[model samples]
Target: MEATDCRRAFPSFDEPALKATFDITLVADKELTALSNMDVKEEKILESGKKATSFNTSPVMSTYLVAFIVGELSYVESNYFRVPVRVYATPGMEDRCKFSAELGARTLEFFEKKFDVPYPLPKMDMVGIHDFSAGAMENWGLVTYRVVDLLFDEENDNANTKQRVAEVVQHELAHQWFGNLVTMDWWDGLWLNEGFATWMSWYSCNSFYPDWKVWETYVGDNLQSCLALDSLRSSHPVEVPVKRADEVNQIFDAISYSKGSCIVKMVSIILGEDTFIRGISRYLKRHQYGNTETGDLWKALSEESGLDVAGIMDTWTSKVGFPVLTVSEDGNTIHVRQNRFLATGDVKPEEDTTIYPLSLALRNKSGKVENINLDKREISIDLSKYDASSAFYKLNADQAGLYRTLYPPERVVKLSQAGADNLLSVEDRVGLIADTASLSVSGYQKTSALLDLISLWKNEKEPNVWMEMLKRFGAIRKTWIFQPESTTDALKQLLGELVLPKVNELGWNFHAEESLLQQQLKGTLFSSAVSSENDKIVKEALSLFEKYASGDAKAVHPNIRAAVFGAAAKYGDEATWQRLVDVYTSPKSSVEGLAAITALGGAKNVDLQKKTIKLTLDGTVRSQDVFYVLNGLSTNVAGIQILWDWLREEWDAITKKFPANMGLLLNIIYICTGSLATPQHLKEFDEFFKSKDTKGFDKAVSISRDRLVSRIAWLERDVKDVEEWLAKHQSSTKL
Candidate 1:
């Protein structure tokens, strides 16, 4: 029901701005129930022995949000809010809806209070659709979710699964006001709906559970992803032009969802949070049940903040890429310059022309923040007043801006030391690691420099900081997959040294009284340890997996179950693989099934890898869930070549399985070919696609090509540098 798919359901003016009120009526079997965007008004038994249900007239909404369902559905209801909030699933799964039902009710109440608006509808219903596409759809009051994203078994599911469900429920509920009440005028303004929902969901989730520290995760998860995709030359503007229906699916990427939210976050930091919320509340109240363009939102914000909101934000939305702020210092002044950043590290003169309005919220050792703006290409500020000699200052403090900050090498070292001393916020530490990693990839700095900077963070405690570090290490390892075995072993040894201590400290047990962050941290450390082939962790994981596979459900903790299964697949024989398949076939919960499917790709045996790939097309995997298997294979060095070869051999069959227009075809293309880094790999990729029509996913191909080129350049530029660093440090690395 997103991106103008509403026309496929019925004939009408299907544009977003052309909203209409709908009166829905359904005739179904007497035992089934019917639901719509509104509450039911009447139900009657027909003479033909069926039931007819009529709903109240819905408020003005886009056609895409118009939904109806007639099924033998069972629901769990909550009266904790202004109206009834219900979570529905098949009859046998009613108990699984209790968590979502309570969370959804509380989220609705939280949003109503924040936005200063009431829930206009009489009831809210969230249903789990087994074959649904997308994570979840915000279909007015009747939201539809993929069952895996909605249902949860608190005792059996991991901490990550709980976090995902909470965020998805809160994200869809946010659309009730941001997307449904105030619609986007056209497809080009889709970010207005998606970006705001993403930002609002995090905002509300943080409020409901501050202990989750969602904002820290946002720096690593949302901010870095957008920055990565936007660094490519093939990337489009956040407000990209969509000339055809097929082009709309291509723009539903990291730019619109992640970068768009990052922009909103930047604006909120500039204007105080309270003022930002006030301005958005005014905007929503003014445009209730109406359509809007991007400018309308800025105008409302300008009226509240008394600034040229559009002047500061227009270029950010219209431009294709973001800027990199290069910082240097003189005796008493600090100099900063902005330029367009590219992953290939080769920005032509024409590509480096845009100047972004930057917010340099500089902070010093005293915890005082200085709000400074650089609207031009370069600027100089006096730092003597802040005692710059005695204290270190960080720009883009807390990473509230959309641009990357490149400090001098010495400053990077100082910041890393500050992070180690616990003098910086979690967001600041994440941004420091992210910035250095990116700068290294783009050639603004050397790979050795990034390695040196992160080496100082061996004592880091925050999960998000470690997550960023591990991601950077993973990128390096993947790009060097074809190097000598000795080189890859050295990198693995380095990873073991960096992560094993944390793994041993956290151990492989889940405590009921632990904070959510600690639980997530423990899982991350164990997974990294297993991947690095740490002998102790691998031995422990195998023992636990053996017991778990032998019918002891509690042998392995839910937090580390996925890692244990992966170790079993990677090190065990055919019998272990068969047990994993059995678990996948009959899982206790949806998350457990997915964990098994993802682990299947970790099989080190070539025959087992082939078997996993065959499962994708042998009717064992649902069409919607094929990506999980392919994505897992893409990450496995043992399975990467196998998956690529399978793609080349089965191109037509794979395309037929996932049509180009469904938006999933892009995911298939990425998972199949995105990891290739060598020049010969690029040639093969280009040669294979020479005769195929890439009309719908042409952008995907271009982005993949761009990434491959970047990886090739990085490997060529830093291969010897990384090898030497590892050689020098390998003697001191501990297991």
Candidate 2:
């Protein structure tokens, strides 16, 4: 009854604007407990000798927040501020819920101060259901979570898992104020709730765990995710018009979550942290226990920050794409021109007069920061006082804005100089790399240029930079991994050279005094190492897998479990594959089970690939997690064609499988279309999806089609140049 289906539970107005009080009564077994939005008022015995519990009338809330659960669930309770917090799970898994409980209580207390609003509900329950989806739902007094996102075991789970658990907890609790207390009027303003929560969850998590670099995680993961979908032609605007339930479902995509969150981050930078928080507090207090639209937030922020915050933010949320700031030198000033940034290169006709309220951060030669707001298409900053002729100015200082910055090629080379990585901040470096990667894939820049820029990062020790590089390189690598044998071999060698040195520097073991982020980087580096098939890394991973199988106490730590298991599956024979499958099928934590499935999907044999494809649809994999197998199958070079065949063979059954959830199919489509290098791959993708019942899934199909088209264009534009560069690099290294 959460989303848009509260009418099914009881008779009531289901629209978000129709906020009302709920007096819920439940009749259940005497041994069971019932929980709702409000504290219990009374419990009485029915004529049949059954217990009936009625809760106090709830505060004004939307129908989505009106819920109750009656069960014999186990829980661990604690106190946060004046409010009590209880974390619940299935009976035997009660101990696994403690971490989320501690994290959730801390998060609620933090928000109470940050939002300038105290906890409204007397008690809050965070429940982890085994079959839950959507990561977690913020249901006022009671939050619901998937078991994997909420539960963590001390010895079995790693820092990465705990970080995920903490972030999810923080995200859902932030909603206690943003969504539960003052929700959007309707689905048209969904981003107001989701976007704020997404951005704040990372902000709150960073405040709590400064060492993890959660903001960088936002940039490297969430922000980049938005750029991927936004680059597609089928991408939707943030404030999407929702006239039907299906339209409502389509809007919960990267555009709403990622782009909206990034824009919010951009505005937050301009407003300054303290000012931004104050504005947020005002917005929440003014609209508490009521519904809001996007306008209400801007009005509050403008009143508090003394800026047209909403006016500055309107262009971003109303549009589907962002601008790329082109900077050039003009006499004693730096001239900047804004143009719509497209992944496939060039701008559209209607985007000419299109403007963005740019938050310009210009860094001078003295390392001073000057912030400017461009409410127009063009602006100039006089740099004569800073000796403009000597050194160039850096725009979008520290990457404070959501848009990309395109520097002249010579200027880019200057910035890519040795030791210059330390001159600029990590966020800008991440921005530069991400923008350049986007350009490379789109033909605006060559793969060689991207490679040259990344060579400067060869000595980079920052965890977030390495994380970005790992992901970008993997995306580019996936485009042509199925090339001719020689070309593919050369490509593999080049990739190994790019990442293995960093892996060697980081090493495989956890270091004393190292931060959790640094430790997490080890897992990513090892995954890169195995993917590249570095001799030293492959040997080490195999040894670790063998030692663990032979019952060695300290062989492969849980942190690198997936990497070792993947290596074993990639290089092992029938026996190793069977061992992984047996362990995967047995009862275990979600992470452990997913790790085994990951290895099974990475198997190098075609027969094993077929088996994996079958498992994706079969009941073996959870419906919510079938994308894991789909993605894994496409990741393996031997199964790309096999995956296509399976897609055609079972298109109807697959689409019909999830009548309730269609967005999950979009992710699978993206993964399957990832390796659409050849024309035949594109044709096959079109023949299957376009010829089927893809009415509600048109945007997804469009995105996947555009993805394949872009991959094909990338191959045409960059493959030859990349091959030449790889050959030259290989010869030079040998010399």
Candidate 3:
């Protein structure tokens, strides 16, 4: 229904602004149930002994919101909201719908309160579609989700699974108001729908479960994801022009979802939470059952805050990339310079034209935040008045801006020390790590500097900070995937040293009373330790995996089940691989099946890798789940080459299989080619796609190529720097 696909269903003016009321009627077998965007108004027996169900006329809505489904479905209902909320699935999976039904009802109620609007529809029905291409479609009152996103088992699924289901359910529910009620005028304003929904989902989720600390994770997950993509030359503006349907799919990327939400978050921070929500509520009320451009939202926000919101936000949305602020200090005044940032570290003068409205909220030892804006290329600020001692000052406090900060190398060390002394917020620590790592890759700082900085965080307590550090290390590891065996071993040793203590401290046990973050941290540390090939962790993982594979249900905790399977696959023989395949063939739940598929990609043996690849093409794996297997393979050194070769050999058959689903094909292309880091790989990628007509996925291919070029340049520029650092600090512990 999204991105102008409604015309494929029926003939009508399919653009989003062309709103109409739909009278949907379905004729199905008498035993099957029928559903639409509205409640059923009448039912009768058809002449052919089938049932004919006619739904009430829907409210004035876009063509995409019209939906009708006839299937043998069962549902779990909840009375938590004023209107009936139900989660439906196939007959056998009714029990799994209970969690989503309850969560969905609560989320709808939360949105209704926050938006200052009641649920406009009579009933809210969410269904699990077996072969869904996207995560979920917010089709007016009838939302459709992939089975995995809407169904959950509290006992069998891990903490990550629970969080994912909650976020997805909440995200789609949010669109009920943002997308369905107040629609976007055209495809260019798609972010107006997606970005607001993404931001609202996190806001409501945090309110519902504050202990989860979803905001902390947002820095590492959402902020960093968008920054990575937006740094590329192939990236587009947030409000990109989309004249055709083919161009729309490419904009449904990190820039629109992650970067777009980041812009919303930055504005909220500037305006204060209460004021921001008030403005959003006002916008929704004024535009209910109507279409809007991006300016409509800005006008409402500006009126509420008494500021030129449009002036502050237009460049951010209309521009293609963000800026990096380089900070230097002299006596008391600190000079800050802003320039367009690119991952390749080679921004030409022509490309550095955008003067973004930056939020330079400076913080120091006194815990006072100065709200300063830098609209020019450079600015100087005197901090002596704020902090006489000049202990430590950080720009872009809490990383609220859509820009990165580059401190002097010595200042970076001081920030690390400050973090160790508990003087920085979790967001500050994460931003420091993210910025330093990115700077190192782009040659703004030496790779050794980043190595030294992360080496000091072994005792860091926060899970989010550790997660950010691990991701940086992972990027370095991937860039140097083709390095000498000794170099790779040294990198793994460093990783093992950083994570082993945490692994031992947390142990491999779960308790109901432990916080969700604690459970997630334990799992992350254990998996990382195992990946580093530590003897003790690998031995323990195999032992648990052996017992679990032999039908002992309690041998491994659900929290670390994937890690155990991955360890066994990475280090075991053919027998272990076969055991994992059997588990994939017949699993207790969909979660277990996905875990097995992902673990199969970690198999180091060539024959095992081939076997796993074969399973993806055969009927054994669902087409919708093929990306899981390919993504797993992309992480393995041996499997990376194997996956690219397979993708090349099977491109035609793959395209034929997924001709209609551009999003899935785009994911497959990324999984197959995104990890390639060598110049030779880039040449080969270009040669292969040069002749192919990549009309639907041209942007994906361009991004992949651009990423490879950046990786190759980074490696060529910093190989000696990384190698020397690793050699000097190489651990005696063997991988």
Candidate 4:
């Protein structure tokens, strides 16, 4: 029910602008209820003793959002401003459906209020299916979700579950207004539909679950995810022009969902938040039940704010990559320059003149603030108005701007010092760490720069900062794990010193009153500890796993179970692995099942890890969930080699078994590339992916290839410094 798949479901013109009214009728078992976009028009028993139901013709809408479901589904019903709202699931899942059902109703009301448009449709139904894939489908009045994304059992579910379900509900509820009510004119403008939903959903979810800090989570999850992928040479322009239907799916990536929304947020920063919201409200009202391109939005926003949003944002949408700002202070003026951002360290000749009309946030020497807008290739902002001879500044204050920031050597030292003093806000910390991580891997900046920054922020306690910092450590670890034999011990020893102290500070115990993020970060911290050969952390993790396995403890904190299971598998014997298998066989929730599936990648021995990979291709792992194993196994250095070998051995069978689902296929190849430190590793990975039908994965393959490019580049640029640092830090304990 996504993109261009509507033609297969019904006979109709599938073009987005060729809207239609669907009059759907379904015949099913007499006991089952039928639902559709509109209220039921008629229901009767046919001569064949089957129930036939017809729905009222829906309002004019695109084909993809037109949907109906017939099943023995029970509902948890509620109302938002008198419109009936319900969440449907199998009879046994009624309790689990309650949270999303209520949230969906409230979210519908929230969007209505925010967009200044009433809900065009009569009712909304969010159905959680047992076998639903692609995360969640925003199917108009009939939003469909996987069980894990929609349902949360009050007793068994934790904060993560509640937060995820509420956010997905908010996400789909947003589509009801943006995609269903007002559609995109063409596939080229698909970002208008998705980007609007992504941006508003975060605001809507924060409207309800302020305590969950959904907006803050967006900075970590969506913004950072986009930054990581968009910096690559393989990344597509946000407003991509497509000629084939097959190409459309590839464009529905992080670029469309996350980066597009980030651009929208960056626009909001320029246009004040209230002014931006008002512009969206007016745009939705003006274009109600119609189509729009990127320009329409800019027109509405520009008219409201008088900021010439179109003039600025046109480059952002049309360009394929973002810029990395080199913020330097000279005399009394601050200079901001733009260049093509490339993780591979080589910009094509065509992109050399690329410049961005980016925004900058600077502080005066007295801590007074000034904002500058750069429209040319490079510009300088005069700080004489602030009455300061010397200016102190930080790029991308609050991390609202969606570009990387580089600092001079002296600036880096000052920023690192600021990080230690907690002078930087939480968002600034996330931004700095993410930029440093990307720069270090790409060889634009040395590994020592990133290490110095993280060293200063090792005591950082914010959830987003810590979570992002842990992921940065993964990148740093991958960069060094395959260095020359002379530097191997030094690399591991340095990582242990950097990470194990944090693990000790946050032990195995989960406090009842801790924030949900604080709880989850413990697992991230512990896994890093295990990866670096810290025995005390591993021993403690195994002890907790053993106690939880034999029913000795009341229950393990849901957040730490995967880390516990992974640690057990990596450091324990056969019995421990069997216990994890049992958890997979009989999971209390699909949430638990996923943790078990990922833990399977952490097998202690490489041979055992290969067997797990075999199990993944067999009936054990669902085809949709193979990404979890590939993604999880990337952390296990031994498992990374095994996954690559498995793909090479089973490429043909994999293609046949999972046809055209390049997301799953490319993930296996993508994870393998992260461990690429040698030319042999690069040759093996690039050759295999190139030999496959990677049409849906051109971007993914390019990303994996670039990871190798960056790693090789890093080895050339930074390994000498790494060797010196490692020699000083290396201990007797071999990792």
Candidate 5:
């Protein structure tokens, strides 16, 4: 059952007012285990012979936050705050559970001390579910995590992954109070819960892992997703509406999580941490076990700061896109104008009237930081008095502000070359690189900008800094390399000597190595034009997969196995491909059956591709099974056609018969059509689009327009045919 469905399981309301006991029950499969809030109060072998267990219901509290899971679990149990804490994982994953246990315990301790509240639940259980869709869910005292997100192997000292686990765990734990205890009135106030959680996650993780710049790391990852969505025509208010159950899931996005966090951080940076925490504490107390909206959060902050948050945050949050603050230096005057820049293209530029509390940061040559704000469209900062040689300015220096850069072309060029260490804070630098890389695709950015970023870490002193630089550089390299012959031996030598050596030096263990290898292969393989050297790399990858695939099934993690097969599918010989097909057809195939299908879907053979599509649409396919197949098909145009055909053939049947599939279809449509929403496909795609549910379908359509259609418009130089089609459909369709 969906978590929302559980509302009826107990006397629970969406608001925080509900205080009810959830009499929890779990029919744990003999192969798996279970966990809950309190210690297992009752455990028995059922008459029918199943491991039936029950945990004591939590203290009086809202129910939406409650969570439960049953899976193959191995746990290390301990006591913290006089409350039980068990970090659970799949069988043979006991070793990984240790990392999470340490992190979770520390996280619980941090929150207990910070909030000055007694731990409310009887026991805290962090269970790693292999197939969990989200990072980790804060289910009151019982948290359910994805295996990778929660579990960290002792052997795997990959600092990045370990840091991520600790950070994510703390983030969810904090939600115990922020989201679970004090719930949002409507989904609109989702930022209040998620944004705060995201911000707190970075803050807590940075405290716990001092070496890791958690806030910057988070913002770097976040900026990509936020900029992508914000540039989209479909972008909505951060505090978006959730009138139906499905709408709740749509808002669990970058804007709601990362950008929302950015917004919260902005408030904290501007209002000062003391005021931010004080305001949040007041909001929690005032809304404990009650419902509140966005205004309520603004009200709380306003009460503390004696400043109006409504006017400022509302302008940013209520609107769909972000502002590009163009700062130009003309003599002593620095002119600033806010505009919009799309991740894929420059679409809706900022109107002259668009406004926000423009928190500005100006760092001079001496590394002194100055704060300034621009309320109007244009503001002149007199820099005439400053040393001429000292004239260097970084807007939103700490990445405290929420907007893209519109600096001089030379400045954009310089920032790209400087990487994270020099021109910008580590977090903000990633944003610059991503934005610049997007521009490079359009010929607006120079390729040298990319090479500079890639070559950055060679000179960095800190290992973590070096590693981050390598990671981002590696990412850009992969994105830039698509055509055959794009790979050079010189480039390969750089990656091998510089990139691969650092990865190995980190001693990231087999799992982390495999993960990075996958990323590296993605960039290195297709990057070069089809050549003997490229074939050599492909053969090497195939050899690794074959060697690993034949290993002790128990030795390989399911994800690693999936990756091996995925890589093999990308670069394998005829015999290797056959072996993969054999695995797919074999009845003894494990949960990785869908993955095998993905491998075959991408096979050069058209017939096999069609069969892969059929495999997904077949009644034998589980709803869960569709994801891999859908993803595989999305890699190319032919696969996309097959998917579209299946949708066309079975739309009515699937919609009527597979009720559980509606949400999945919504997601699939968004990803599939959205990816190809360029001018060429817009006309063909119009036949399938029906705007019966504006709030629902329009979201997907708008996303497609932003990500796919807009990019196509720029590339093709005309969109009259697409515009005509969309216009006709808009009039005819119910939306």
Candidate 6:
């Protein structure tokens, strides 16, 4: 049985007295070993030609913590006292699984040290499942992991993937305390459970692996997914009400995971890090093996830190969306205001009177201040406090707070001029640059400033910071004001001035036997320069691509592939697109190959678009490929007819084979039905939409209303149309 089905098959109460043993028996396929949560009390090769391993009853815990997996399992087994520690995965993935186990051991060790308690469970077995629906699960003593989330071969794993695996394992292990031990009383406190664990996981990873910049990545990259959703009008607070299991799953999104974790980070920042840890330790001790609500956490925190935890968290946890901190300074005083910030083109913001629990940090010529409250909607800090009036001042300093900043155009210019000399964090710098791009600045001037900022980061920052800056600069490079040639030069100049320095300074060498390209890849984008004086950037990237494509090739980094394609599609030869398509269609293609296909299709290259669609016709592509081809095809006239006809002729077969994958197809169908509808095509798509004998129409509508249509709204940037679409689809489009 599937895990959730197992929960339903044996329902039990959450009451303290309700404890019982469960004996589950299922035939295991030959590829895997049968395993469960407790000690191996019984093991027998049955008459049915199956090996059955029965685990003794576990401690009373939440049903969601239960796990079972069948896979080609190799194990690294040990013991912490009587409790066995076993980590298992598919045979080839054992080394990375071992690393993951190491991370878990370290985290468990830390928790044991910090919590002043012994390891509670009698056995801990972590198994990496090939097709897990979520990242990882904390199942009392039996944690299950996604293959990608657990296995990390040191010799083959990229720096970034290794770090991500470590953090994912740490996060799940932490749940043994925050979630599995002291459960949330209801789903409204789900954020507290998830958020606390997410934060602690990163904290633990950072403590173990300092170079990873785990927190920065979590803030800049992952947290944005949550913020993007939360910025929508339909968003709820991190701590949201979930009266049913379906409702509980709905909040298991970026908001509950990343943004909710960010809030915990903010709490750590606001109250000192030690204070937050002390509070959490007190919380776990107070509620050990019991259930707790959001308020229970607040009570423990308040008692431990002697802070007004309730007042602060209540405003943040119950409120929907984040504030816009608009800061301005004169010769005497600095002004800050609390307001909602929708992206510049967003329509119909909520009522303006809602207040955000604003955390303020002021850094003059000196380092950052502890914390100040901008409790009022508009508050001013007197700049007469022993520093120059025009000193570097950053709002939402160090990205500690969860709001967007509204640095006006003049301030952008000033910061651009200041460059890396300013004290803002890399994320804050990214926000500043993005904010500048969104504002009403002259395109050429913005380009120059962006180039300057990019130059500053390349020259002075770490790899992660450099990557963030490259992404920001690359994002706005192709705006309407600059010709592709001009943008290419600017990119070239930015990349050109830096490659040799990086190669020589960082000792990135490529010998015949040990090419740098053979290194396990990291990151998900690539780019290069083509200046007359610095063409090595382009040449090296192309060389790497070619080397990576050779039969004995190293695994090409996802970031490198994205970067190469992005660079090539913009300015590299047209032949580069053909090479990409060739690799994508090849039988040797992996998931990265699919990603390249998606990126190329998303690039809006007409020829590349046709090639992607044609791949599906060969029946060599995955189901997702069909969706990408369809989704990409939706925007164009030539492919739209092909798409419409396919929907008409093969709609039933497609839905029958892949019901869950039909949503994006239907969404594209919906949009095309409205605009490009022929009476015949419209009838077909409409019938397909209405004739859902399966279980995904609401999901289809949700996809359209939440992701697809919202993107179209931004592309169209027509406020009235956005409002009309929202009105028509209010029931289905809750972000």
Worst lDDT run of 10 residues, candidate 1, spans 383-392
By lDDT, rank the candidates, best first.
3, 1, 2, 4, 5, 6
Tens-digit lDDT string for candidate 5 (1-735): 223555665545644444466678788765667766666788888887788888876666655666667766678876654676788865676776777776777788877777656567777888877555456788887788766577775442233456568778888898888877777766678777888888888778768766555565555566556766776656777877667776766667667887787788778877887788778878877876666778888899999999898877877777666766767777557778765555555554343246666767766656567777777766777764433231455666656567766666777656655544465555556556555555544334444554555555454433334434454545434332321232323344445545443433432124433433243333322222122234444454456566656864444334344544666765555666667666655523233455566666556566666766665556545554466677776655567667767766766665554343144555666655644634446766665665334444566666765555554544343223223433443455445
Candidate 4, residue 414: how far the Cα is off, in Å: 1.1
TM-score per prediction, in order, is: 0.97, 0.95, 0.98, 0.93, 0.77, 0.76
Q: Which lDDT values do the candidates have, in the order given?
A: 0.87, 0.79, 0.88, 0.76, 0.61, 0.58
lDDT of 6 by residue, 255-366 (tens): 7887788778777876877777888888888877778888888887888888888888777787777766777777657778777654433434444556877767655546
The C-alpha stretches of model 6 lying farther than 4 A from their native spots are 1-21, 25-32, 78-82, 344-350, 386-388, 422-431, 434-460, 477-542, 545-550, 554-735
Q: How many clashes in candidate 4?
A: 0
lDDT against true structure, model 2: 0.79
lDDT tens string, model 3, 1-735?
776677888898998899999998898999999999999999999889999999999999999788888998999999999999999998888888999999999998988898899989999999999778889889988999988888998777888888888998999999998989999999898876788888888998899889999889998889999899999999989998988788888788889999889999988987898999999999999999999999999999999999899988999899999999998888778889999999999999999999998878888787777778798999888887667334688887787888989888888888889888888889888988999988887879888888888898889989899889988998998888898988888889889989998889879899999888889888888999998999999999999988987889788888899999889888778888877777777776677878888898888788888898988788788888899889889887789998899889999988887763458888888889978988889889989999999888898888988888888989998999999888777642334
Find the number of clashing residue pairs for candidate 6.
6
Q: Score candidate 1 by lDDT.
A: 0.87
Worst 10 residues of 4 by lDDT: 726-735
Relative to the unseen true structure, what is the Cα RMSD of model 6? 8.5
lDDT-best of 3 and 6: 3
Cα distance off (Å), candidate 2, residue 624: 1.4
lDDT minimum window of 10 residues, candidate 5: 523-532
The C-alpha local distance difference test score for the whole of candidate 6 amounts to: 0.58
> Cα lDDT for residue 169, model 5?
89
lDDT of 6 at 378: 90
Clash pairs (backbone) in predicted model 2:
none
